[model samples]
Structures are given as structure tokens and as C-alpha cells.
Target: MDRKIFRLAIPNIISNITVPLIGLANIGIAGHLDSAKYIGAMSLGVTIFNMIYWNFSFLRMSTSGFTSQALGARNLTEATSVLLRSVIVSVSLGVLIILLQYPIGQFAFRFILSGEEIKGYVEAYFRICVWGAPAVLTMYAFNGWFLGMQNAKTPMFIAIFNNILNIGLNFTFVFGLGMDIEGIALGTLLSQIITLAVTVTVWSLKYGRLKKYLRYADLWNKVALRSFFKVNADVFVRTFLLTIVTGFFTFASSSMGDTLLAVNALLMEFFMLFSYFMDGFAYAGEALTGKFVGAGDRKNLKAMIRRLFFWGFLVNLVAVIAYSFFPGELISLLTDKAEVIRVAKSYTFWTVLIPITGFAAFLWDGVFIGATLSKEMRNTMIFASMMFFACYFIAVPLLGNNGLWLSFILYLGMRAFVQTVIARKRLKLI
Candidate 1:
């Protein structure tokens, strides 16, 4: 079990690490620009895209769970069908997002307050990056499918290539050509398309045999489709609430002022950094749990869960230590702006606490995802989100930014607490 956990986790951890590095690259580039407005605009723009992509994360989560189960059962046809269904849903949703881009942009701006100075840059970033919707969502399905098949290395390679390409392109476009936010957007858009192409190519070479099972009639299998939507609907609601909380975080910071918003954005990179690292272990739990469930291997399932929790704790312990000790050195990587860095230092404690507060939630998310227990996941998310808003309302009035950080911390802790209680009651070791 230990070997299996590390086998799946280590590659995923490396791959996931790159995701935060990409964010760091974007922030670093924007930070070097003449003003912090570029960073703020990029954050707003990315949030809008996150709203769209993360909301549809069901494509990845559901597909991984379903496919892993099929593989565990040695049902290649069913695994292929799962991927096909996810692709169909993702492509359709992506197209819808493109069509509704204007309305989506309008809705996003309602939550963002960069004033006129930064608003134009935000809009430009959104318009240009929105074109990657199909590629972005489709890659979600592909990435999920790959993980489900226990092929983390492929996704890792693809992710590394994608991020490196994006950073290189951004540097060239922004600095070499002297462009602005649009240059960053263009780099991201182009990289996504290229990554999607690579994903398809890799699938063709490695798992092309599975295509034999891609019958269109099977694509609409009533039983399978019902299960798919039932799980995905719960995830959809959960992700939507998550988006709301995150978007509100940015909105709240923006309400304070542009410099504060920029400070918060840089700080968010810490959260993102922690999440991506933890998600590697979480992904392992998902893959292993689903396989065990599919095979009805109760003994191994119980063992894997224990191992996952153990490693999860160790990983977060390391993260907390790093965040606590090297706060200044870490945040400095994102920007040289002394003021933004100063404000960020004040909030560094929140980042230090996040890994410890949130690691369980991240781990259990994978557990439930692997078990296809979407209702449990969604219910816990709803409860945590409610607690978040309540804490924010109560604390922000008294503590100001400190209150906001408190609310966010409480939200993470609540997720871990609520989900653990629920999982303990529902999950049967036998």
C-alpha cells in the first residue's frame, strides 16, 4: 500500500507542483510590470476562468472515479465509455461557455472592483483567454481519464510541458515583445491548445485499443448516464459554492483597495501552492480507493485509507513548517514591490495555517471522489461554505482583513471536521 501510494503520489506531486509554478510565473511577470494593476487584472481574469473550469470539474472528478472503477474491474469497454461521456459533456459545456462569454464577463465584473483603470485589462484578458474553453475543459477529461487508469506520469509530463511552454511563451510575448495582460492571456490560450493536442496524441498511442469500445449507442447508456449525472450534479453544486467563496474572497479584497487586492492575489498563490501539492496525494487516494471499491477489496481499501491519511498528515506538516519559517523569502518570489510584499507579510500567518487546517478536507475529497460519494462531498461543502460566510460576516466587522483570514481558515477547518465526521459514519471498513 505504501509503495502504491508513493507510486501514484510522487509523480502527481511533481506535476501538481508545476501548476503553482505557472501561477507564480504569471504573478512574477505581472509584478515586474510598471504597476500592480496587471497582477490584479490577471487575478480577476483567472478567477473568471476558474469559475468556468472549476465549476465543470465534474468532468475530471467523475470521470476519474468511474474510469478507475472500470479498470479495477478489468472492464476496458466501460472505462472507454466513461471517457467518451466525459468528453461529450465537457465539449458541450465548453461551447456553451464560449457562447455566453459576454454574459459571463459581465457577471464576473459585477464581483470585481478594479475601477476603470484595471477593468479594461481584465476584459481584454477574459476575451482572449475564453477562446481556450474547449481545449481547457477537454484536457480536464483527458487528464482525469489518465489518472483513473493509474497513469499519473503521462499527466505529469503533459502538465510540465504545458506549464513550461506557457511560461516561455509569456516571457517572450510580454517582455520580448513588450505586451501586457493580453500577452499573458495569449500565452495561456496557445499553451492549452497545444497541450490538448499532445493529450490526444498520447491517448492515441497508448490506449487506442480502448477506442473499440467507443460505441455511440453505449455513450448514452441509461444506467451509466444516470450515475454520471447524479455524481456530477453533486460535484457541480460543490464546485459552484467553492467558486463563490473564492470569488468573494477576491471581491472582498478588492473592496479594500487595488494594492490590497494585489497583495491578496500574491498571497493566494500560497493557497494554490498548498492545494496543488496536497492534491497529488488526494489523487492517489482517488485512484486507489476506486480500484479497491470496484474489486470489493475491503482489506486493501481500509489499508489504503490509513496510509493516505498518514502521508497526508506528513505532507501538510512539512508545508506548514515551510510556510511558517520562510514566509518572506517565499512571497518575495512573486513580486519585488515592497508595499505588496509588506501587506503580504502581515497575512503570511494565514498561509501557514492553511495546510494544517485544510489537509484533511483535501484528502477526503479524494476518498469520496474515488468512492463516487458525491452527495457526501457536496453536503459537506455546503455546510462549510455556510460556516465560511457566517464567520466572515461576524469577523470582518471586528477584525477587518484579519477577520477575512479568520473566516477563510474557519472554512477550511470546517470542511475537514464536517467531512471526517460524515465519512466516519458512512464509510464501512468491512
Candidate 2:
């Protein structure tokens, strides 16, 4: 069980780590440019894309869940159909995003940008990068499908390849050609397209034999299509609620003041780091849960769940200890601003509670996703999100920023608690 979990978890951790590196690399490159506006423009452009891409991440989550179950059942035809249907949906959505880029860009820029000087740079970047939507979204499908097939290494390799190619191209375009943010955007676009080609090639070389199971009729089977949409829609709603909670956290922090906002952002890095690790285990839970459920192996399913929680709590302990002991060191790594560090240190206790409150929710998310229990996941998120707001409203009046952290902590705990009850009642796995 440990080996199985690690097989999926380690590669996923590496993949998750690489994801943030690309953003950091882009920012680092922009920081060395002629003006600070370049950095702001690049950051805004990336934020817009992040918001767009994040909403569509259900493509990967849904594909992985359904595909894993099909594979567990030894239903090659259904597995192939799952892949085909996911790719079709991804591409269709990607193209739609491209077609609607004008309005999307206008709406996003108007809400996100405050400075006119940075707007043009962001617009140029958006125009170039928007064309990569199909490739990016399609890759989401492939990555999810691969994970469902119990092949995390492939996704990890794809991410690494994409990162290296993107960084190299960005350097060549920006420095060699003397271009601005457009060069960075172009690098991202070309890398996405190239990496997608590589993904297809990898799929062909490794899993081409599965093509024999592919049937065009299966792709459009009404029942299968309906189930797919149902699962994905549930995940989309859950994700949207999650976005609202996290986004509101940031917004609320900013309302307190810039220093408090910086403090919150800096402290949230601990949560982000813990999430990256926890999410890896969650990915493992998803894969194993789907497999065991599909095979109707209740014993193994329960065993996997136990081992997953063991590892989850183990990681949570480590995170709590580190956050408690090294708050200043971590804050220093992110910024040299003494005031921010001092303010952030005052909130370090919140970071210590983050892993304890959050690990179960992260792990359960993977398990529920793998089991295709999307409705339950959505319900729990809805309850938790509402509680988040209620806690914030009631407590913020008395506790200030600490109230915000308190609300977030309770929200995380509530999600885990509710999901645990659901797992016990529905899956009988408590």
C-alpha cells in the first residue's frame, strides 16, 4: 500500500513543484527587465490565465476518476472512450475560450488592472498566450488520463519537459530577440503546443495498443456522456466555491491593509507548501480508490484509505512543526521586508494550524474524486464555503485578521469532518 501510494505521490509532488517554478521563472525574468511595469504586466497576465485555467481543471480531475475506474474494471473500451470524450470536451472548451478571448480579456483587465501603462503589455501577452488554450486544456486531459491509467511518471515527465522548454524559449526570445513580455508569452504558447505534441507521441508509443478498443459510438453513448458531464459539473461547482473562499480570503486581507495583506500572503505560503505535498497523496488516493472501488475490492479499499490517512497525518505533523519553528526563516525567503516579516510572524500560529486543519480535506478530496463521488464533494464544499463566510462575518468584527484565519481553519476542518461522515455513511469506510 505504501509503495502504491508513493508511486503516484512522488511523481505528483515533483509535477506540482514544477508548476510553481514556471510562474516564478517568468516573474524572475521579468524582474530583470528595463522597467517594473514589465513585472506587474507579466504578473497580471499570468493571474488572468491562472483564473481561466483553474476553472477548467475539472477536465483533468474528471478524466482521471472515470478512466481509473474503467481501467480497474478492465473495461478498455470504456477507458478509451473516456479519453476520447475528455479530449473532445477539452478542445471544444479551449477553442471557445479563444473565440471569446476579446470579451474575457476586456472583463479580466478591467477588473484586474489599475494602471494604464501596464494594460497594453498585458493585452499583448494575453493575445499571444490565449492561442495556447487548446494545447493547455488538451494536455490537462492527457495528464488526467495518464494518472487514471496509474502512470504518474508520464505526467511528471511532461511537466518537466514543458518547464525546461518554456524557460529556454523565454530566455531565447526575450534576450536573443530583444522582445518584451510578448516574448515570454510566445515562449509559453510554443512550449505548450510542442509539449502537447510530445504528449501525443508518448501516448502513441506507449498506449497505442489501447486504440483497438476505441469506438466512435462509445464516445457519444448517451449514458456515458451524461455521467461524464454530471461528474465534471459537480467538480466545477466545488472548484468554483473553493476559488471564492480563497479569493475572498485574499480580498479580505487586503481590506485590512497592505501590510496585513502582505502578511497573509506570506503566511499562506506555508499552506501552499503543505497543500502541494498533501495534494500528491490525494492524487494517490484518487487513483487507488478508483481502482479498488471499480474492482469491488472493499478490503483493499479500506486498507488504502487507512494507509493514506496515516501518511497524510504524518506529513501534516511535519508541516506543523516546520511552520511553528521556522516562521521567520520562511518569511525571509519570500521577502526581505522587515515589517512584512514581523507582521507575518505574528500570524505564524495560523500557519501551524493550517496543516492540521487542512490535510484530511486534501486527502479526502483525492479519495472522493477517485471514487467519482462528485456530488458529495460539491455538497461538502458548499457547506464549508458558507461556514467560511459566516465565520468571517461574525468573527472579523471582533478578531480582525485573526478572525479571517480562524474562519479559514474552521472551513478546512468542516470539509474534512463532513467528508469523513459521508465516507462512513456512503462508502462504509470509516
Candidate 3:
């Protein structure tokens, strides 16, 4: 059991780890180059993409659930069909995104950056980077399919390849080639293209013998597609809510003005790192629970959950201890700005707080996804989101930024509690 979990999780951890590197890479590259506005520009620019892309994150999340369920049932054609359907849906969404890019770009820039200099750099990055939409979304589908198949190594390789490409190309275009944001933009675009291509090639080699399933017929079959849409739609709502919740933090931080905006932006990297690390185990839970439930092996499922929960808590405790023990050293990795560091230090509690507060929520989320319990997940998020805003509205005027961070801690903790209560009700565990 340990071997199975570790086999699946290590690559996921590595793959999951690089995701943060993608944003931080942009921030780091921009930060090291010159001015604060550049960092602001990069952060806001990426946030805009994040808000947009993250809404569609259900494409990956739902695909994993459905595809893994199909694989677990040993329904090869259905599993293959799931992959086909996702690629078509994801690609169509991407093309639609490009067609309407201008207004979207404008709205994002006007709202997020607003300041003239930062806005200009952000718009420049947006224009050039918009071209990667198709490739990146396609890669989202590919990633989902790979994880669903219990093959974390493929994504690990692709993610590593994707980042190395992004970093190297960013260096060439931004510094070595003098492209600045354009370099970063172009590097990002090409990396997606590479990731998508390699993913498709791998899919063919590993499972392509089931080629009959990979047809336009599979892509648009209304009945199966509707099921796909329903599952993904539920997941989309779940992720959309997540986006909105995070958007609040962004909106609140941005409202506090640029220094706070920028500090929260950098501090987000710290908290994002903790989430990224925890997601490693969450991904493992998703895979293991999917396998067990699909096989209807309830006993193994229960045992696996027990072990995974322990693993999740132990790792989080270590993270909290590390954050508590060594403060400044971790900050230096993110920025040269002492102000950003100082402000981040003040709110370091979020880091120490998130692992304990949020870890169970993530583990339970994996279990829910593995069970494909979208409605229940929706209810939990809805309840938690309400608690967050209520807590935020009540706390912010009194606590300021610390209150803002506290709302987050409350949000994660409540989300876990609500989910736990619901899970018991659903399974009659009580």
C-alpha cells in the first residue's frame, strides 16, 4: 500500500511542484530583472490568466474522476472515450477563448492592473501569451487522462519538460534575446505546445491500440458527452467557486492598494507552495480511492483512507514546524524586496495555519472526487464560502490584513469540517 501510494505520489509531487514554479518563474524572472512595476505587471498578468484558466480547471478535475472510474470498471472503450471527449471539449473551449481574446484581455487589464505602466506591460504579455490558450487547455486534458490512468510519471515528465522549456525560453526571449515580457509570453506559449504534443504521442504509444475510440464520433456523441458535461459542469461549479473565493482575496488585496497587492501576490507564492505540496498527497488519495471504489473493494478503500489521512497530517505538521522554525530563509527564495519579505513575515501565520486547517479538506476532496460526489462537494464549498465572506466582512474592519488571512484559515478549516460531517451522513458512518 505504501509502495502504491508513493509510486503514484512522487511524480505527482514533482509535477505538482512545477506548477507553482510556472507562476513563480514568471514572477522571479520579472522580479530579478529590474523594477517593482515589472513584478506587479507580471503578477497581475498571471493572475488574470489564472482566474481565466482556473475556472476551467474542472476540465482536468472531472476528467480524472470520470476516466479513472471508467478504467477501474475495466471498461477500456469507455475510458478511451473519456479521453477523446475531453480533448474535443477542451480544444473547443480554447478556440472560443481565442476568438474573444480582445475584450477579455481588456477587461482583465482594466480591472486588475489599472495603473498605466503596469497595465501596459500586462497588456503586452496578454497579447502575446493569448496564443497559448489552445495548447495549454489541451495539456489540461492530457494531464487529466494521464492521472486517471494511474500513470503519474507521464505528467511528471511532461511537467518537468514544460517548466524547463518555459524557464529556458523565458531566459532566451526575456534576457538573452531582449524580449522582456514577450520572451516570457512566448516561452510560456511554446511550452504548452510541446506539452500537448508529447502528451498525445504518449497516449498513442501506450493506449493507441484502442484507436477506434479516438474518433470525432466519440467527441460529439451527445449522450456520453452530456454525461461528461454534467460531471464537468458540477466540477466547473466547484472550481468556479474556488476561483471566486480566491478572487476575493485578490480583490481585497488589490483594494488595499499596490503594496498590499504586491505583497499578497508574493505571499501567495508561499501559501501556494504549501497547497502544492499537500496536493501531492491529495492526488494520491484521488488515485487510490478511485481504484478502490471502482473495484468495490470497500475494505481496502477504508484502510487506504486511514493511512493517507495520517500521511497528510504528518507532512502538514512538519511544514508548520518548518515555517515556525525558520522564517527569513524561506522568504529570500521568493524576492529581493525587503518590504515584501517584511509584510510576508507578518502574515506568515497563513503558512503555518493552512496545512492544519486545509489539509483534511484537501484529503476529503480527493475522496469525494474519487467517489465522483460532485453535488456533495458543491454543498460543502457553498457552505464554506458563505462562512468565509461572513467571517471576512465581520473581521476585516477590525483586523485588517491579518483578518484577511484569518478568513482564509477559517475558510479551509470550515470546509474540512463541513465535508466531514456530510461524508458521515452520506455513508451512514455515524
Candidate 4:
């Protein structure tokens, strides 16, 4: 029963691809509309949700790390228990988010977004998407569990199917039904609900035998629960910082005016697109690293890192080539606004460089997360974030929009450098 890395990576790659495919699909759906306002609105709205939900990404990351460790120890019982606890926490948080959507949207807009028009779109998008929080969060937990067990295919299936459904629904509602932003919201909402159901069904069929080991009693153990909290707390800080940085990117873009905001948003889409692809390899690293660490196999961990870094470099190289050739083609497809396209073209240099500066950081995130070195992950982010702000304040006043882009590139560079430094601290690399 030797593990085939590509076998695992293929599914993850498929699943990861769907995420940005959906984003592109959403932008495409909105692109058909007459106004750039729709484009800006959807971008702002989604960024807000991204900030909130991304902060809780630990639900997936922590669950994968913990469950993979248990599974590696040949403890199916503990694996099931770990998953159950993660779902409970994820769903509880989801409920709280849905309930506070209105106030949250208001606060986020006033504090984070720069204008009333952007706020209006952001609020409208949130109002509709809030209802789907439970489904989305639950998906995160299931995605992690499946990946942890070396079952990337299941999550990939769900991710691809969900994207297909989302795209179809978006077309129907936005164009056929004239639904607009409400359509975008409903598309994601319905798609997530379906995906969650499919995930559970797959879980039952695949990991069903382990259900017998379901021990609700274990959730009460202070020692086990304490470890869970410790890991999650560290991951939470890391995720929160991630969310805050994302928020700052959007907020800063918004402050630069509507045109630059749209430009920055489109630029972000390019970076996020590249990131989703890179995440597939990181995910492979995360799952494999967690398993190897849990089994106390440092040799295999090194092997996994070598293979992942190889693949990461190749993949990012392709992205750099793609973005370099036709940045306009991608931007035009996302929005119909000619002005937005022009601005985005002007900033293409930063987008092209993003894959280079940030690729290592994204891949290393998988490595660190799989190892459940969340405290280290948190520390890396803290340093990177501090660098982000220090660079931003000095650059923003002088360079304006270009400064923001360069700062972000540096932010990613900082993340990689800091993570590598901390890895040496933990692994005694020196």
C-alpha cells in the first residue's frame, strides 16, 4: 500500500481549480450586465465574505492536521472524533455569522470599504449569501477531513460539481431570471448546500465503517480538547491575520477611488487565481507532512517536501507565463468596464510578479499547516504582516497605487522568508 503522490495530488488539483473557476464564472456572469457597478459590487461583496469566512479557514486546516495525525497513528476512532469536533465548532461559528450578517455587513462596510456605492453592493451581496454560511463552513471541515485521509478525490469531485452547479445557476438567475447580485448569492448558496450534502454522502459510503467509533464522550476530555484548542487558537490567529491582510488590501484599494478599487480587485483575482493552483501542491504537502509527522517518519517528510517544491516551481512558472502573455484577455473577461481593463493593464507588472514572490509562501503554508505547527505559522504571519504595514505606510503615500501593489508583493516575499526562518527554528535546519 504505497502512497502515490500524484494520485493524491490530481484530485486536489481538480478540487482547487474549481474554486477560481467559480470566481471567474461569477465575474463572467456579472460581466454580461451593463454596469461596472455590478462588477465592483460583486467583488466588494465577495471580499467581505472572504474576510469573514477565510478567518475561519482554520476549521479546515486544523481538522486536516489533527485528523491526519490520528489516521496516521492507525486510530480510526480518533479520526472520527476529531472530525466530529471540528464540524461542531465550524457549524456553531457558521450560525453565529448568519445571525450577525446585517450588523456585520454594516460595520465592515463603514469601517473597511471606502464609499456608499461600494457599500451598497457589498451589503446587497452579503444579505443574500449569509444564509449559506452553515453549508460553506461545514464544507470546509469535510474538505479537510477527506484530504487528511488521502482522499483528495472526494473533495475534488464536490468542488468541481459545486462549481458547475454554481456557474449554471448563475447563468440562469443572472441572465435568464434577471436576478443580478441576488442571483450570484443564490448560486453560491445553493451550490454549497448541494456540495455539503454530496460530501456527507461520500463520507458515509467511504468512511462509513469508522462511524462505529464515534465517541461523543471524547469531546469532554480536557487534555484532548485542550490540544485541539491550542492548535485551533494558533491557526485562528494565523487565519485572522490572513483575513485582516485581505481586508486591508480591499480597503486600501477602495480608498484609492472607484477606478483603482476595481483595478485592484481585478488584480487580486489574478493573484487569487494563481494561488488556488499553487494551493493544490501545498495541500498535498500539508496532508503528507501531517501524516508523516504523525507517524514519526521524518525521512518521508523530506521526500514529500522535495516533490512538492518541484511541482510548485513548475506550476508557478506556468502561471507567470500565462499572466505575462495576456493580462488584458483575463481582465476583459471579468468585467465589461473599459476603464477597469485599462487600469488593470497598467498594473499587470505586479500581477505577473505575484507568482514569483508568493509561490513559496503559499506552498509552505501547506507544509506548516500539515505539520500543525500553527504557532510557528502564527509567528511567521505576524512578522510578515508587520512588514506588510511598514512597507505600506511608506510606499502608499509616495507611490499611491503602485506602492500598494509592490507592498503586497513584498508581503508575500516576507511570508516565505519568515516561514523558512521559523522552520529552521523548529526543525534545526541550520
Which pairs clash inside model 2?
Answer: none
**TM-score of decoy 2:** 0.89
lDDT of each: 0.91, 0.85, 0.80, 0.83
The per-residue C-alpha lDDT of model 1 at residue 207 equals 93
Q: Whole-model lDDT for model 3 versus the true structure?
A: 0.80
Give the per-residue lDDT of model 2 (tens digit) for 1-430.
Answer: 8999999999998987787667667766775676645655665677677678877889999999999999999998999999999899999999999999999989877654235667788899999999999999999899889999999999999999999999999999999999989999999999999999999999999999999999998889999999999999999999888876776675566456546755665566567668877888999999898888888888999899999999899989988889888888876665556666677788889888889888999999999989999999999999999999999999999999999999999999999899999988878742
Estimate candidate 4's alpha-carbon lDDT, on a 0 to 1 scale: 0.83
Residues 103-201, candidate 4, lDDT per residue (tens digit)? 887788776455676567667778888888998888889889988997888888788888899989888888889887888888888888888888888
Candidate 4 wrongly placed segments (more than 4 Å): 1-3, 112-115, 428-430
lDDT of 1 by residue, 180-295 (tens): 88899999999999999999998999999878777778778899999999999999999999988988998898888988899889888889999999999999999999998888
Each prediction's TM-score against the native? 0.98, 0.89, 0.94, 0.96
Better of 1 and 2 by lDDT: 1
Find the 10 residues in a row with the least total lDDT in model 4.
1-10
- Root-mean-square deviation of every model: 1.0, 3.0, 2.1, 1.8
lDDT of 3 by residue, 312-376 (tens): 88888988898887767876776788777787788777777877888899888888887778888
lDDT of 3 at 145: 77
Report how far residue 75 has shifted in candidate 3, in Å: 0.6
